[model samples]
Target chain A: MTVQTWTYILVGITFALYIGIAIWSRAGSTKEFYVAGGGVSPLANGMATAADWMSAASFISMAGIIAFAGYDGSVYLMGWTGGYVLLALLLAPYLRKFGKFTVPDFIGDRYYSKTARIVAVFCALIVSFTYVAGQMRGVGLVFSRFLEVDINTGVIIGMIIVLFYAVLGGMKGITYTQVAQYCVLIFAFMVPAIFISIQMTGNPIPQLGMGSTLNDGSGMYLLDKLDGLSTELGFNEYTDGSKSVTDVFMITLALMVGTAGLPHVIVRFFTVKRVKDARKSAGWALLLIAILYTTAPAVSVFARTNMINTVSDQEYASMPAWFKTWEKTKLITFEDKNGDGKIQYVADAKQNELTVDNDIMVLANPEIANLPSWVIALVAAGALAAALSTAAGLLLVISASVSHDLIKKVFKPDISEKGELLAARLSAVVAVVIAGYFGINPPGFVAAVVALAFGLAAASFFPAIVLGIFYKKMNKEGAIAGMVIGISLMIFYMLKFKFGIFDGGKSAVAGLQKDWWFGISPEGFGSIAMLVNFVVSIVILQFTPAPPEDVQEIVEDIRIPSGAGQAVDH
Target chain B: MSDKQKKASAYWRENVRYLFLLLSIWFAVSYGAGILFKEALDTIQIGGFKLGFWFAQQGAIYVFVILIFVYVRLMNKLDKKYGYNE
Candidate 1:
């Protein structure tokens, strides 16, 4: 069968499975909608959280990013996975013991101020929305690129599928759906990686294969060959680091704290049955996520090596079929500026005539390796699964924040459960539409915006949540002041550097070195802002009145596992 | 403070100390071996790759998974010790 035909069959089966799960496990109450009735087993919840966390960025774009960036890409590898360690250790179980439906529920109650809740709600919306828009675009881009459909049609179809599950079963439906998605995406991701790994390296395991010699017995190591190829082509050594050590450190820090702080991921812990289950489930989630995170670097190496061996310095007249196909999509362009018959891939942009989009490396890798057509189709299904699963999770967070946190908890405390559920679904529809709009007509910032979401979460929510958990003295005034200052500084810095605002094309500022503060870009500035948050909160706590006795009691309460309440009982 | 509160505080202190111990390992592997000392570590090869590059991209992730499980085991023991087990 044609690759397109196979994609339809595989993707159709997965879509039907998700809708089936949604209808079968439809949420019956606000409790179910918000936290899957808190009945999910730790292992199941772990899979769901794993699916929710590994978005299109992780599945489709990460290896491509790593392929180009070399060792610098390790920032993403360590930053993302390491953050789970922080989450599992510092936050997850305590939050589960705290027994909350949403992140704001903890923040608002911990600070003992409705104003604090409002501030948290504001942050949640900002983080979720900014993050969701990118997921929506990923959904649309995958559909249009692979399914032979227009971008808008792809986004609307995506919205409908998400609306069905998210609006119907809420977290309950999304949970089971994500479990299925985790299976599909992981299976799909590993197959091609395994094939490519075997094709190049003698080993079957991609991890060991990355550090193994070539299958053809070239006598040279894979990394050694790649380094030689990279330098021959006038590029940095593939094994050598790319970014400055300091920038890599800061970026990794931002991603770590940011992942821990993300509302969508944090909310997943609230699904499992017990405090112990929460801890176990976080471990499970990381083990599951590591399956992909570890495989990604290996895939990056394979794809990079394959491209160089197949394309570079080869005659343009004999350009491969996959290269021609991608060139038609404008993702790969060959200028042949030197008019040399041979294609040259090099570091110098002008000197190198062939420019291939990094995003295409993973999607094109299977084809480049002359793999079977079905593997190509399987990749499409995997990309869709990754994009849709994360989109569904993010949409639920947005919906719950609206219906539960803002409307039911704050504005209309008297609203009925039925009314709140209806509001949640309605808000989800609105959110999907707004997200779809952004996906269809994405701003210039859409690409970098997910990283911005991380920065925002790192600067604002991580400090607030961590302090609220550990520090008994964390009061409303201090929490509020910290969030306001931390988030404001991050926004201002992002505006100054990323969007090129504030300074209006002016050269450099007081604390900045070459338009960057300490050579840290907006993406890495979150770690610094989080530091400022800790310092500011501590300073303010010295002046503000201590939290009430009960608030202190809550801190001590979450510190243990007893009296965690009937978290799994219906 | 009451007797139970005092015990809980001690348990909490031990828990915090354990967290520091684990996090220190986490920091050392990712930030230390991965980034700062990556060049020096690169001089040493592990199989086909540099030790530092391996830590940055693959080794650290593997360690992260291990650490989380270790924390889970330690905390469960702590929970039992504190009579906080479910």
Candidate 2:
């Protein structure tokens, strides 16, 4: 059967399964909507959390990005995973002990101030929207490539699917659906990787295969061969990094902090039954995530080597069928520069006639190696599962923040549970539409926007939540001031450096990197902003009176893990 | 302070100590070996992998998973020791 037929069968079955789960798990009350009735088992929550955490960026773009960045990509490998350490140790259990439905609930209640909650709500929205936009775009990309649908149409289909599960079943439906998604995505990612690993190095394990000798009878290590091939094509050795050590350090720190702070990820802990479960679930989530994370770099190496060998300096007419298929999608193009039909996949921009989108490396890997059509089709289903699961999680966060934090908590404190549930569903629909618009007309590359989301979360949420939990003296005045300053500084730096808004717009962004603050890129500037938040909060706290005695008591209460009741609504 | 309060504080202190120790290991592996000392460690290779590169891309991740599980065990034991276990 053709790849498209297999894709239709697989994608259709997965979507049907997700919808079935949503129908079966329809949330009946606000508790179910927000925290899945606060009774999710640790193992199930762990699977759901893993699916929620690994977005399109991790599933689709990361390996491709790493292939191009080479050793410099270690920032993502270390930065993204290491954050789970922060989440598991510093945040998850305590937050679970606090027993809240949303991040703003802790901030508002702990600080004993409405302003602090509002600031948290604002940051949550910004962070979630940026992150979700990337997920929607990922959905659109998969649909457009595999199903031959327009990107906008794909986004609309995605929005409808997410809206169905999210509005109907809320966290309950999303949780069970995500468990299914985790299975689909992990299975899909590993099958091709293992296939390619065995084919390339005669080893079944991708992680070990990456270090083993090539199977071509050359008796050369895979990395050694890749490095040799890379330099021969005027590229840096694949094992060496070109980014400055300081930048890599700061960027890694920012991503780690940000991952710990992301509202959607942190909120997943609220669904579990106990503080101990929260801690255990974080372990399971990271372990599940590591299965894919550890294998990504190895896949990048395999795909990069395969791509360079197949297309570099090869005649365009003899290019494989997958090349032609991808070419029609406009993701891979060859201009036949120098009046020759040979493809020049080179380091120099002026002479390089082929432009391949980073996404193609993973999406086309199975086809490049002549893997069966079913395997290729499975990747499509997996990418959709990944993109949709994360999109639903972020959408839930956005909707919950608006419905629970703003409307229910602040604007209409007397709103009914039924009214609040309605508001949540309505907010989700609006959020999905906005997200689909961004997907159809993306602001930038999916990964870059997602990285900035992490930076935003790191800058604003991490410090406030940490201080709120760890320090009984963390007053509302201090927390509010710190969050405002930290988020504002991060936004200013991102606009100036990432978008070049201050220097005349997107065109100036290229030249603005040289003027980065202290040589820190906008992506890494979160660490600096987070530092400022900690300092500003501490300084402000010295002048302000300590938090009221009751608030301090609440802090002491959360520190103990024995009696973490169901996530409280009021 | 009451006996309960004292016990809670003791548990908190122990948790902080564990966090400090485990996080130090986390930092040493990822930030230390993976980035700062990567070049120096690249001089040494394991199998077909450079030590630093392996840490950056592979080794650090394995260690992170282990560290979290370690923290989970320590925290659970501390809860039981302090009579906070459910």
Candidate 3:
């Protein structure tokens, strides 16, 4: 069978498995819909969280970013993975103890203010939407490549699939489906890496293969060759740090706090039955996620080395079939800079002008390594799994924010349970549609928007949740003001850098850019926003009265693991 | 021993301090030694690998996994001492 046909068959089988899991695990009540009845095993929750956490960006774009960015890409590695540590240490157990269906619910009750709930809802929507759009685009890209459909049609199909499962199963369905996705994605990612590693280094383990000597015995390590190739092509050596120290520090901090703050990730903790279960699940989830995170840098190094050795200094017409295929997809393009038919991939920045999209690196890695067509098809399936799993998780959060937090809590407290469930499903459909639209016409790269989503979440929701759990004195005014300032500053900073809207004209900030405070990129500014929120909350609380005495008792109760008789009905 | 007195606070404190020390090492390897001070460490090579490069791409992640397992073992011991064993 042709590679395209094999890809279609494998992908179709994976889709059937996911839909089947969702159908089997369909939620029966509002409680099940929101928190999967708080009965998920830590092991199962770990798998689901891994699938949800490793989105299209991790599966498809991360290796590409690492391949091209060289040492600079460590920001993503450290930032993304380190966030889990923060989540485990600082956020997950307390949030699980709070035992609410959604993040907005926790903020609303903790702050004891309707306005605080609304502010939380706004932040959740912005963060979830920003993140979901990237997932949709990932699904569309995979569909376009493997299924031979236009990107728009692929996005629409993805929307339909997500809507069917997410609306039908809610958290219960999404959780089980995400587990299946984790299996498919991880298996697919590893197969190609293993094959390429053995082919290049005779090492069966990709992680070890990265540091092992090459097969040719050129008296040089694999990394040494990569460093030489990259520097020769105007890229920094793979191991050398080129970014300003402050930028790396800020970005890593931002990602760590942002990961800890993301509503979708935190909500997963709530699905567990006990605080200890939540903690165990966090550890397991990090383990599963680390498997991919650790392998990505190896993949990046291998792909970069292979690309330069194969393509640089070769005639344009002699480029491999994989190059031609990727070029046809508009993912890999050559401008013929200096009108040289002989492509020069060299250390001169001017000559290294081959415009390669970062998203295509992992997607094209199998082709680059001359792996079997089945492995290529598996990668396409894995990318879809990563994107679709995350999209469902984010969509669920959006729906819950609207139906549970907004309509049920603020607008119509008297709504029936059944009515609320229907509302949640309807809102989920709306969110999917909006996300699908953005996917078809993506405003930016998957990583950038994802970073912005993290920034917004970190700024607004993380501080409030953390303070509410750890500090008893934090009151309504403090929580509300902290979220407001945190979210506003984040938005203002993002807009200033991303669009240059406040600098009077696009050209004004183009040459003389000064938006970032002390050389911090907008992506890394979330840590600052989070700190601002924390400081503001503490300062404001000193002036305002403490939370009611009953609130302090509730705080004490949440800190302990036991004596919570039953789940409180919000 | 009294119920509260049976649990040695020193054991928990020592374990937590160890976890902190290990985690600090992890942070230094990835963020400090690997990213910030990479150029300074580039002058040194270990086993044909640049010292800083090895830390950034490989060393820190390995340490993080090790730290987690170490913490888990310590926590189990702490739970036993506190009579909160699961």
Candidate 4:
């Protein structure tokens, strides 16, 4: 069968499977909608969390980004995975014991102020919306490339599927469907990587293959060979980083703290039954996530080496079938700047003739290696699974915050359970439409938007939740001031540097890098803003009265972890 | 303070101690070895991989997974000792 036929078969089957799971696990009450009835098994919750956490960025764009960035890419690998340690140790168990359905629920009740809760709800919406837009774009990218459809059409299809499951089953539906997605995505990611590893190094394990000698009897190490090819093309060495050490350090810290602070990931703990289960599930989630995270760098090495060998200095007309197909999608374009028939894939912009989108490296890897059509099709299904699972998870947080925190807690205390569930479903539909709009017109690349979402979460949510649990005397005034200032700082920095809004629009972004504050990129500035938040909150606390005695007791009770009852709405 | 409050404080103290130890390792592996001393560590290589590069991309992630499990085991044991396990 052809690649498109295989993609149709595989994608169709996976969609059916997700819809089937959603229907079977359809939620009836607000409890099931918000926290999956607070009874998910640790193993199952771990699988769901892994799927929810690893989005299209990890599955589709990360290896491609690493292939280009070389050693600088380690910031992503370490920063994203290391955050789980902070989550498991500092956040998960205590939050689970607090026994709330949404992250804003914990913030509101712990701070004992509606103002603090409103700030939290606003941050959650912005972060989740920013993150979900990237997922929708990922879905569109996969559909347009594999199914031979328009990217906008692909996004609409993805939004409909996610809306169906997230609205019907809420957390319950998303959880079970995500488990299936985890299986599909992991299998799809590993198969091509393992095949490429064996083809290049005569080794089955990608991790070892990256460190082993090439299979061609050249006896040269893979990393050394890649480094040679890179410098020959005017690029940096594959094993040496070009980014300043401080920028890398700051970006890593931001991503780590942001991962711990993300509302969707933190809320996963509430689904499990006990505090111990929450801790255990975090371990399982990290192990599963680590499997993909560790293998990505190896795949990066392979794809980069293979890409350079195949495409550089090659004749454009004699290019392979896959190149032509990708060209039709406009993701890979060849411009003969010097009127030369040969394609120049060099690092120099003036001389370079070929432009390949970072997303295509993973999606086209199987085809680039002449793998079977079914393998290529499986990658498409895997990419969809990754994008849809994360989108559904983020949508749930959006709905829960709006329906539970804003409407039920603040606006309408006498609202019925059925009315709240209806509200949640309605908000999810609205969220999906907005997300789909962003999908049709993305602000940036998949990984870049996702990374900024982390920064936002790190600036706004991480400190508040940490202090709420760790510092009993963290008053509402301090938290509210900290969150508002921290998030505002993050947004200002992002607009000025990333979008270049403050420094004469997007065209001036390149020139503005030299003016970065303390030499930190916009992506890394979250750590700085988070520090400011901590300082401001602590300083404000001295002038303000301490938290109520009952609030202090609540903090003490969460620390014990003996009687974490079922997650309740009130 | 009451006996229950005192016992809770001790348990909390022990928990904080474990967090400090585990987080220290986490910081050392990723930030310390992976970034700060990466150039120095890159001088040493194993099986065609630079030490610092391995630490940044592979070693640190493996350590993170282990750290979580270790915390889980320690926390579980502490819960039982403090008569807090369900």
Candidate 5:
């Protein structure tokens, strides 16, 4: 079959599997809907969490970023994975013990203030919506490229499929679907990497192939070859330090904390039965995630080396078929800046030949290596799995924040369980529509916007949640002020650089050396925002009285793994 | 001491200390060796990969996975000791 036909079939089969799973696992009660009835096997929960965490950015854009950025891209790998450690150690178990359906529920109860809960709800919405838009856009891009549809139509089709499973199965249905997605995404990612690794180094294992000597007998390691080629072409060395020390440290720190703080990820811990199970599931999830994360750097190095060697010295008119195909998709463009037919792929600031989108590296790698049509088709399926699984997880968080946190807790405590479930489904549909709109017309690259989402989550929600569990004296006023101030500072810094607010016009920020504070880039400013939140919270709490006696009791109850009665009913 | 009581507190304390030590190593590798003193470490190389680059891209992640496996094994022992075995 043609690549397009194969893509259609693979994607069609995936959709059928997800819908079937949803139908089979349809939740019958509020408990099942919210937390899968707390019956999910630790292994199954681990798989689902892996799928939920690895969004379109991870599947579609991460390798591409590493391919182009070389050593600099390590910030993403370290930050994203390290955050999991923080989550497992510092947050997940206690939150699971608290046994709440939504993050805001924990914050509200812990702080004993309605305003704190409302602030948390708003923060969750902003982070989830911003992150979801990127996932929806990823879905659209995959469909548009492989299925020959417009991006918007692709997004709507994905929306319909997701809505079917998400509304019907709730958390239970989404959990099983995520397991299937994890399979598809990982298989899609590894197949290409294995092919390229064998071709380049005669080693089938991509991770091992990365450090092995090249088969060409050039007396150089694979990474060394890549470093040489990249620097020769005016790019930084493939494995050298390029970013400022402080910026890299801060960005990695922010992303790590942000990953740990994301409510959607933390909520997955609630699906297991006990605190020990929560910890075990975290270990399993990291094991699964590491299989892919470790392989990504290898893929990045191989793709970069292969691309440079193939194209750098070639005449522009003789560019390869893969180049032409990608150029047609607008992912790889030839600027002809020097007006020469021979393309000079070099690292020189002025002599770069191909203006490639880093997002396309992983997707286009199969084509670059001349892999079979089926592998390309598998990539299309993989991208959908990554995007849809994450979109489903984010939508769940948004709906729960509205229905569980705002409506049930604040406005309508008298609502029935059935009424609450319906409200959650309705709110999920609304979130999907809003996310779909932005996905079709993305304002920025997938990875960049996702980093911003992380920044917001880290700055606002993380400190408050961490303090709530660890500090018994933290008060309601302190929690609300911290969240508001944290979120506002993050937004201000992001808008000033992203929208050129400080440059007096809608142009990119000028004089990077002069504009940024303490030489920290926008991506790194999240650590600063989080620091501000922690200090503000502690300082404010000293003036405010401790939480009421009842709240302290709740805190004590949440700390113990046992003797907390079964999870509270919605 | 009671069989259940003997193992529970002892095992739990041991597991916590192990986690603390492992996490400290994780912090040092990624945040310290890779980022803070990266310039110094970059001067060293292994198999054509700079030392700092190796830590950031490959070494730290490999260590993280190993750490998790280590934790799992330790926790399993603790669970058995506490008579919480499934």
Candidate 6:
């Protein structure tokens, strides 16, 4: 069969599996809908959490980014994984002990104010929506390239598929489906990696191969050769640091804090039965995540080396079929700026007329390597699985925030369970549709805002949740004020430098290019914003009324592991 | 305070201590070797890769996975000691 036929078969089988799981695990009550009835085993929950957290960003784009950025890419590798440490140690167990379905539930009840819950609900919606928009766009991007569907039509199809399962099974459906997705995606990712690793370095393990000698008779080390090639092309050393030390420090910190505080991931811990399971589940999630996270760098190195060898100094007419195919797709382009027939991939923009989008590095790697048609098909399915799994998780967070947190808890306390569940499902439909629309006609700066979603969460939620768990004296006023100040600062900085809003919307300035505060970009500013949040909360708490006695009692209870009462169905 | 409260407090204190120990290792491997002292560490080589690069992209992640399991074990034992184990 042809490659397109294989792609259809693979994606079809996976979607069918997800829909089947959704039907079997259809949520019976709000408990099942929200937290899978709090019965998921640690291992399965771990797999689901890994799938929910990885997203299309990690699956499709991370290796591509790493391929070009070289050692500077370590920030993503460390930041994304290291956050689980903070989650497992500082946050997850306590949140599970709190026995709640959503992050907003914790803030609302713990702060003992409907106003606080409302504030948290707003934050959750904003963070989740920003994140889901990226996932929807990812789905559209994959479908358009492989399935021959228009980006908008692909988004509508994705929305319909998600609406069917998510509206029916809610968190339960999403969880089981994610577990299946994790398996498919990891397998798909590893197959091509193993083939390439062996082909290049005579080692099947990509991680070791990354640090191993090349199979080529030159006896040169892989990284050493990559470094030599990079310098020859006017690029920074592939294995040495290029980014500012301070910026790397801050970006990694921001991503870590943001990962811990994301509502979708934190809510995964709510599915397990006991506090100990929350701790164990975190370990499971990280281990599963590490499988892909570690392999990504190896993939990066492989793609980089392969690409440099294939195109650099090679005649544009004699370039490989993959090159021509990608060129047709406009993912890879060559302009003989110097009137040389040979395509030169170099760091100098004037002579370097070969433009390759970083995102294509991962997607096109299989084709570039001449891998079988089945392997390419598997990758298409894996990308879809990654996008869909994350979109489903994010939509649930939006649904729960609107129906359970805002509408039921804050606005109408008298709503029946049946009414609330219907509300949750209905809101999920609306949320998925809205996310789909944004995926098609992605709003101006949606990509920019997506970058800041982590910053916003890191700035806003991480400190609030951490303090609520650890600080007994944290009053509602301090939490609310800190969240506001934290998120606002992040947005203001992103606009000022990234979009040039502060400079009359020129979007570029002569002298203002490198004029960042302490050399910190908007991506790195979250760690600073988070620190400010902590300080603001503490200083304000000194004068504010202390948390109520019952709130302190609840905090004390969450601190212990013994009586993690079964998650309440409500 | 009750005797049980004292025991629970001690357990909590021990848990925090273990976290401190493990997280210190975490910081040393990633932020320390991967960034601050990367140049110093790069003078050393592992297989074909620079030691610092290995730590950044590979070693730190391995250590993080190990650290979580260690924390899990410590917390579980602490829970059992304080009569908080399920």
- State the displacement of the C-alpha of residue A238, model 2, in Å, after optimal TM-score superposition: 0.7
Error of 5 at A208 (Å): 1.1
- State the displacement of the C-alpha of residue B8, model 2, in Å, after optimal TM-score superposition: 1.1
Report residue A237 deviation for candidate 5 (angstroms). 1.2
Clashing residue pairs, backbone N/CA/C < 3 A, model 2: none
TM-score of each: 0.98, 0.99, 0.94, 0.99, 0.95, 0.98
User: Which digits, one per residue and each the tens of the lDDT, describe model 4 over residues A1-570?
Assistant: 999999999999999999999999999999999999999999999999999999999999999999989899999999899999999999999999999899999999999999889999999999999899999999998999999898999999999999999999999999999999999999999999999999999999999999999999999999999989999999999999899999999999999999999999999999999999999999999999999999999999999999888899988888889999999988899999988899899989999998898888999899998999999999999999999999999999999999999999999989999999999999999999999999998866545657888889999999999999899899999999999999999989988998888778889999999999999999999999999999889999999999999999999999998788799666
Better of 4 and 5 by lDDT: 4
Judge candidate 4 at residue A9 and give its lDDT: 98
Residue pairs that clash (backbone atoms under 3 angstroms), model 4: none
Two-chain DockQ for model 2: 0.94
* Candidate with the larger DockQ of 3 and 6: 6
Poorest lDDT segment (10 consecutive residues) of candidate 3 chain A: A559-568
What TM-score does structure 4 among the candidates reach?
0.99
TM-score of the A-chain for all models: 0.97, 0.99, 0.97, 0.99, 0.97, 0.98
DockQ of each: 0.91, 0.94, 0.33, 0.94, 0.45, 0.88
TM-score of chain B of each: 0.97, 0.97, 0.72, 0.98, 0.80, 0.95
* Alpha carbon lDDT at A397, candidate 5: 92
Q: Any idea what lDDT model 2 has?
A: 0.94
Q: Cα lDDT of model 5 overall?
A: 0.84
- Cα lDDT listed for each candidate: 0.90, 0.94, 0.83, 0.94, 0.84, 0.90
Off-target runs (Cα >4 Å) in candidate 4 are: A443-448
Where model 1 places Cα greater than 4 Å from the true spot, the runs are A503-513, A567-570
Which residue segments of model 2 deviate by more than 4 Å?
Answer: A444-447
Model 1 in CAPRI terms: which quality?
Answer: high
The predicted structure with the larger lDDT, 3 or 5, is 5
Q: What's the CA error at residue A459 for candidate 5, in Å?
A: 0.6
| Candidate 3: regions farther than 4 A off | A347-349, A444-447, A504-515, A564-567, B1-26, B40-44, B69-86
Q: How many angstroms is residue A158 displaced in model 3 relative to the true structure, after the best TM-score fit?
A: 0.8
